[model samples]
Target: MVIKMRLGKTNLEVNKNGFGALPIQRRNMDDSVEILLHAYENGIDFYDTAHFYTDSEAKLGKAFEDVRENIYLASKGAAEEVDEFWKQLETSLKSMKTDYLDLYQFHNISFCPKGDDDLYKAMLEAKEEGLIKHIGITTHKITFAHEAIESGLYETLQYPFSYLSGKQEINLVNKCKEFDVGFIAMKAMGGGLITNSKASYAYMNQFDNVLPIWGIQKLEELNEFLSYDENTILNDELKKAITKDKKELGEDFCRGCGYCMPCPQDINISMCARMSLWIRRFPAEPYLTEEYLEIMENTNECIECYACVDNCPYELDIPRLLKENYEDYQNVLDGKTKV
Candidate 1:
């Protein structure tokens, strides 16, 4: 049987687990389409994409045309102004090959509540114009998410939710249920920190209102989630393994929210976190070269304003972690230890 769940306050039904199209954007068009088609054939009906994700809208548009009526398509726009918002909506419609989007979200509203209102009004206008079926918003900030739900201007709220989020974020899940707002979970795998797929699936399965969109690029990862629908349960041994992994991952640090982006210094905070894992855990000798050291050290330019730290879902010490990572990266560059 297909695993299905009800999106809050709407008649729409979707797969309890959905496919996130971010990672697949890194792959070639043919490969991405194949993976998306595989996900659809295996009972995934909810597809989340954004105009920001390079070529993701176009790929999903082409792959799902035959099955479009049977699926739910959610897309987001990063537009802040009225004209830009309208332009993005039009671009998304063209890219997705659909006249009406199942859900249209304001992407990553960090602090500007007033701006959110403007966007909400535009979405309402769009809905009136028959361009969107429902309105939604996505955010890395828990405070903004709470506000979105409380404002009742949105039908859904997408946020960074993984085993790594703190109590405040965990409570947001409950609040979504209380407010009858659909909770679409992003970064369910901790952006690759949660290596165990079974653990990730089991943790997400505990939430009834939340629908996790796993960024599946390969058939293997897609098949893994598909297996869960077929009755694959996490055993005692697997539970123990997950616990150990969580402990090692530590607590309260960088939810990979991508808030501190487009740094003036060109430092990639999100990729640095991922590469730090490679420098510490995996065989990343090649990445530890002088060129890579320059990239790691570039984070020193972070003015210590704690902008990223404050915006992080897990409330990580952004500057400190960046500095610590720099040191580790230096050691690896010097050949003191295997990266």
Candidate 2:
């Protein structure tokens, strides 16, 4: 029942329950290390972090420096140019206290990196120098993900895959299997929208080629995945849960990938656009707080420039979504609508 899988061309045997270190950045160093060490001790070894995730890499560094040989470390860089790529690479290495990354990915890119591109060449050089073991690409765009797999450039494809994924996302998983590119699933819990971890775990177990790195920030969250490691068979009950989630979530919801960010108006587009979902799926109190109210209020400042729409991989009308969520939020505040 212990889950393990091979990462396609990379051939790195990994535990099915990979540790996503992004959320750990929110935890202080000591607490982060404790959570990380707890996950590692529970047989989760394949750790994924990124240069953009503040000090997540450093926290991993502190926790596993002594056990470095026993774990697999993967970090990503989003630099487009050669110099910037190197700088990010060095920074990640220094931050993670690692000599090389087991999997180095082109994080959240819209287009696939080509052989002629300087960034791709830099990856090759890094590989040759043993700074990175395998090259991978992570994207939210279905078309671009297909292009990455078909291009045969990436050793793995990390994209958002959950029970709510529609035909295209499921087909992308099949394509990765057909192409022998490792399928690393991000947002497997639908970026916290899909709350049933057991159902998510079982659904992911059906795909032998797909690995889900559950983002863990606390002991309970880590424990949920660990406890399910032995019971991850997709049962009739779990299937029912998946079906219920799919029907409710439907398509056209944000994955909260944050690709459309740094809004000109300083609005938190990712959170604001998905506020309706968050309030309904999670506790309404958090969003109702003063801090969150300020964030939600900023949505009104949007200039309708469609910069967010331009960057959204899902092609969400971000400005419009923001407007709608703001209206709904007002209703909640006024007691006209209930969470």
Candidate 2 residue lDDT tens string, 36-95: 988888888799999999999999999999999898998888888789999999999998
Alpha carbon lDDT at 16, candidate 2: 94
Q: How many clashes in candidate 1?
A: 0
Report lDDT per candidate. 0.80, 0.89
TM-score of each: 0.90, 0.96
List per-candidate RMSD values in Å: 2.5, 1.4
TM accuracy, model 2: 0.96
Candidate 2 residue-wise lDDT at 237: 92
Clashing pairs in model 1?
Answer: none
- Report how far residue 47 has shifted in candidate 1, in Å: 0.5
Q: Model 1 misses residue 254 by how many Å?
A: 2.7
Name the top TM-score candidate.
2
